[model samples]
Target chain A: MKRKIEFATIVEAVKKCCIEGTKVLPQDVYLKLEEAEKNETNSLAKDFLRQCILNADIARNEAMPICQDTGFAVYFIEIGQDVEIIGGTLTEAINEGTRQGYKEGYLRKSIVTDPLFERKNTRDNTPAVIHYDLIAGDKLKITFAPKGGGSENMSGVKMLKPSDGRAGVVDFVVNTVVNASGNPCPPTIVGVGIGGTFEKCAFLAKKALLRKVGEKNPNPLYAELEEEILNKINQSQVGPQGLGGDTTALAVHIEYYPCHIASMPLAVNLNCHAARHYEVEL
Target chain B: METKIIKLTTPLTADKVQSLKAGDRVAISGVIYTGRDAAHKRLVTALDENRELPCNLQDAIIYFVGPCPAKPNTPIGSAGPTTSGRMDAYSPRLIRDCQLRGMIGKGNRSQAVVDAMTQYGCVYFAATGGAGALIAKSIKKAEIIAYEDLGAEAIYRLEVEDFPAVVAIDSSGKSLYK
Candidate 1:
């Protein structure tokens, strides 16, 4: 027998996740900021890191958003083969939830109806970006990560010859971030996606940001790569808010996929220190 | 070395901000205006077409921000600075034309913007990036005065008190970024 999941349940879950995610900075990110502050040598950068912590606390306590740029809603969802969604379409349910969450939570409605020409506000944040996956169990899981424009604008994708190898990847990632400086709101959490096609590489880079701040990649080689890239980035003196210090980045996460032998593709996505994500499983 | 937190009040004049230098922290008070990407485009367009702007921008500080809606009983919500680079194309013109005294936002600016600041006796300040909720406490009032249709990108008159920022570029063309 297939498991029946109510559409309202998913809507409510997404609604709560959107509000909570925007309001509260995740524990892992908060702790990492604390650690960064302790390790920072520059007094100004250290004070800025402390302010980030205080800012998060104020948001959490007051039941308000941590930043004005509440971000574009992006969802990663998984559905079991034996599960059925009833009463409405999954996409509609999520969009409805987003509309309610952003309105009720006092989050900014950032989406403009059209990107280029007549950039009109949607008023209600709707038509969220969603990715779906099929899994074996009788369960449904949804993860919401709000992506702010500042950090997203600084993200990039690059195609490299296989001959360029690890050296090329490191150089590209470091330069892209260091060059951005304070524009993306350092110290940032960097997400690097390697291999795959152009679109898949972009997706992987964003998905990599969902992982815990300190969690290393399961693969030994990628784990080592994460540390190396992170060290090189921190040495650039970007620091907190790019004013200069020892804590330019909290973590560097790399997710990889097998691709055609002919090309190497790389994507780099950056999340501001406010790094907010929340999820639910049912 | 010790750093000083310079105090400032709005409706700023060139003489008032002349002493500001790169690396100095500032606590700004009184009135300032808020305008971001779209609002800037409109403001600059008005200047280009030789039309009058809705608000008086002379000797003003324009903060680059779009705040979250206020919760009941509060004057404003998480009001933080956005990336300043996006406003580059419009800033030099505003600086020279309006006699803009100071600008508050995050990120390094262009060479043209720096050059304008040097010539026009203006300063650029960078707020604590991503510190939105905390910054809101400094904003005492906010009322949309122009381009209300732009929603968050609307131009608003804000009354701020001790609004904190750091001097990113000074009148002498000194910059904190490499």
Candidate 2:
């Protein structure tokens, strides 16, 4: 049976998610900050972590964006095979929801009409970077993340020779994140994507960011890789804002897929301390 | 926090600029101007054409930020520092031509800019990145004075009180990053 879903329902939910996503830091990420503060020994670096905690509190209690760079509104939609749309197309509804939410929620519009030439503000933070997946079920899942430009600018995708192996992947990921230093806003969540093709690996890296901070990969081998990366990053002493401390990164999450026989593709996407992502299933 | 926090105000004086050291926590009060990549681009363009800046740059502090629009009854929203590296291409010229005294933003600066700061007696301060909402509380008033069409990237004049920051680079070319 096809489950009928109203276009308005999705619009309203997207609007709410846009506001809720940027206004409130997820509990898992918030708790991780608290833990980082407790574990960090450098007084100055610990203070930066404290400010992060306090900033989230102010943003939530005052109904303000956690950061001024409300960022590019990104949406990940999963549509079940057994679902039917009642009013309009899914893309149109999502964009409308984004427009209304950014306007009503007082979120900043960061999107440009053109990337190279005019670079005029779109006025509404619309035409979101939407990704869709078709799945089997009668439900729809909407996931939203407000990705800051500073962090997003630091993303990397590299094609490596298969023989480069585990050691090579680890080195590239660490180098990219560490070289980024304070620019990505440290105590960041490192998202690693291994395998897949060029663009596919980058997408995988971004998708990996939606995972809860400190959540382990389902595969135990990959989980061990995550732990190893996390320890190495923290030891870099890049600290909060790359100013120096023991809390450079709170967690590292790795997502992988089988790829071409000869090529090993790797992508790293770093999410700042204000890692905000929210999802709803209907 | 056992560290002694310094309290400073602007338009800053030469003596005051020289007193700061890397890693010193500062609470800045008084007037400052905001700009980001676009505004910096324009300002440098104006200088190239031998035109006056929208505001006098002498002894002025330029904060690299693109703030969220203010809410009802609020001066500004979620105003935080952006990475300063993008401004590297234009900063040395501003320092040499206008005696630009200080800058507030996140991330390390380029060598040429640091050399200019050392040559011209300026300082670089860093705000906690991503702490926008907390930082907005310090901005008492904000008004767009130039390039309104640029929206967030437009230059804004702000009245601030006890704005929190740390010295990332000092007048002598000393830095926190190294």
Candidate 3:
């Protein structure tokens, strides 16, 4: 017999996800902030890093958003085949929960109705970007990430020759961040996607950002590669706000998938220290 | 750190500017109006129309922000600096036409804005971008000054005390980023 999960439970879970996601700022990000503070060489940059930590603390205490950008809400939902949701549709519940969380949490309403003309505010932050996938269990898992535009603006993807290999990937990512400079709010988390098709590579790169900082790839070779990329990125000396210093990037995470024999695609997504994401399983 | 409150109507002198550096903490008292992209566009359009501005811009520091709606019993919600670059195009016009002296926001400014700062002896200050609630504590009061139709984007006359900020760009053409 299939187990039925109440729609209220799903809505409550999503609301909790949004609240926890905005307030906590993630353990990986916290570790990265501490690391960036230690590694920052420029005095101004060091102070800025310290302020970022303090900002996190204040946000936690106040139960408010850590950044003014509150960000565009995006969710990745893994739904089980055996579980049935009652009362309302999943999309309706999620959007309703988003509106409630943004209104109740005092987060900013960043969405506008029309991007081109009549740029009227939607009033409430709504219509989240939801990606759903089906899995084989009775459990429902969801991850909500509030992606700010600064780092989102700096993300890039490319389809290179298989012969170009790892060197090509490194050069592309480093060049992207170096060019970005202080725009994305430095000491960023670099997410690299390799091997998948063009769109898949981009998707994987964003998903890779959700991984914990300092956590190594399961594959030893990939783990070593991540370390190398992290070191090389710091050497750029872009520092915080592009003032030129020792620490430019906090961590480099790479996630890969098998690609076609002839195709080699790479994508890179840069996330600022405000990288806010949280997950819940119901 | 010692705190002092300066009213907005008082003209900012060179001595006042010199007293503050890239990292000095300050609390602005009295009336200071807020304006961002949409309101700025309308203000500039009014100037182009050869009409007077909604509020006097002489010696004023325009804050580039669109704060969240005020919750009940609260003056304002999570008010913080938005990215300053988005307002770069509209800022030079405001500075030149309206005699605006200072700006408060985050990130870097264009060379043209820097040039205007030097020519007009203006300054650009950086408020803590993400520390909205902590920053809000310094603001004792807030009222809608103009552009009420813009919703949260409306112009607000805020009265603040000990609002912490760093001078990102000074009158000497020196940038904090450099």
Candidate 4:
């Protein structure tokens, strides 16, 4: 018999995740900021980093958002093949949770109803961007990532010839951070996606950001590449808020996918130090 | 090597603008108007049509911000600066046409914006980007001034005390964007 789960349970879980994601900066991210604070040379940048830590502490204790830009709600859902959701569609449940969470928690409603024409506010911040995958499990897992516009707007993708090679990828990643500078709220966490189709490449880059800050990839080659990119980005001297210092980026997380031999696609997604993400299981 | 600390009050004048230099840390107080992307479009449109703006632009400083709604008994929720580049297209016009003397936000401005700052005598200050909750401590008052239909993007006049920021660009075209 298939394991049955109530739709209301998913809604409540998602609602809590939304509020928690906005209010709490993950412990790993907090520790990385502490490490960045210790290594920073410029007095001004160090002071700025300290303020970021204090801000997070206040948000956590007060149950408030770390930044005013509460961001667009993005969800990654994993459902078990043996699980059945009763009473409502998964998308509807997730949207309802987002509406209640954002409204009741006092989060900013940053989403617009239309992109090109109407450009009207969605008011309740509904219609969250949802990604779903099926897995062999009996429970439903949901991850909420509130992506802020300042950083999301700075993200970009490039199509490179296979000949561009590793050097090309490094240069592209470094240049993206340099070009973005303080716009994405450095010291930023950079997520790079290599290979795959155009859209998949972008998606991979965003998914990479959900990884814990400072957590290395399981693949040794990719883990080494992550460290190398992080070093090069910090060398850019963009520093904290692009004010010029040694700690331009906290970490660089990369996710790779197989692609055609003829084409190489790369995408860079940046997240501010807030880097808020929370997960729940139902 | 040292960051100079300065205090600035709104309704800024040219002399005050001239005194500010790149790399200085400023604590701004008094009343400053808030407007982001959409409100900027409307304000610039008003300028193009030669219509009166709801707030006086003479020697005024505008903060590029859209704050979260205030909670009970609180003046405002987490309030911080938005990216300055989004306002680049409209900033130069506001400076040249309306005497906009100061801007508060993060990131680098466009060349046209830098040139306008140089020609019109203006300065750019960057607040700590992710420190919204801390920044809110300095904001004592906030009330929507216009465009209420825009929700979070509405224009508001904020009364801040010792609101911290850094001078990213000075009146002399000096910039710390690198």
The clash count for each model shown is 0, 0, 1, 0
lDDT of 3 by residue, B1-178 (tens): 3243333322454456545555444555445677878888888888889988878888777777777666678777667776688788888888787778778887788999888877766778877555566677666688887887777678887777666666778777777664
lDDT of 2 at B96: 92
Flag clash pairs in model 2: none
Residue B148 of model 1, lDDT score? 87
lDDT of candidate 3 over A171-281, digit per residue (tens): 898888888776677778889899879999998888888888767789998899899888888888877656556777888899999999998899999888788898889
- The weakest ten consecutive residues by lDDT in model 2 chain B span B1-10
For candidate 2, the per-residue lDDT at A28 reads 96
lDDT of 1 by residue, A18-105 (tens): 9999999999999999999999999889889988999999999998799899999999999999998999989999999999999999
Better of 3 and 4 by lDDT: 4
Give residue A95's lDDT in candidate 3 (0 to 100).
89
> Which scores higher on DockQ, 1 or 3?
1
Tens digit of per-residue lDDT, candidate 2, span B58-173: 99999999999888999998999998999999889889999999999998899999999999999999999999999999999999999999988999999999999999999998
Give the TM-score, chain B only, in order for the candidates. Answer: 0.97, 0.98, 0.87, 0.97
Model 2 — TM-score against the truth?
Answer: 0.99
lDDT of 1 by residue, B125-157 (tens): 999889999999999999999998988899989
The regions of model 2 sitting more than 4 angstroms off are none
What is the C-alpha local distance difference test score of candidate 1? 0.92
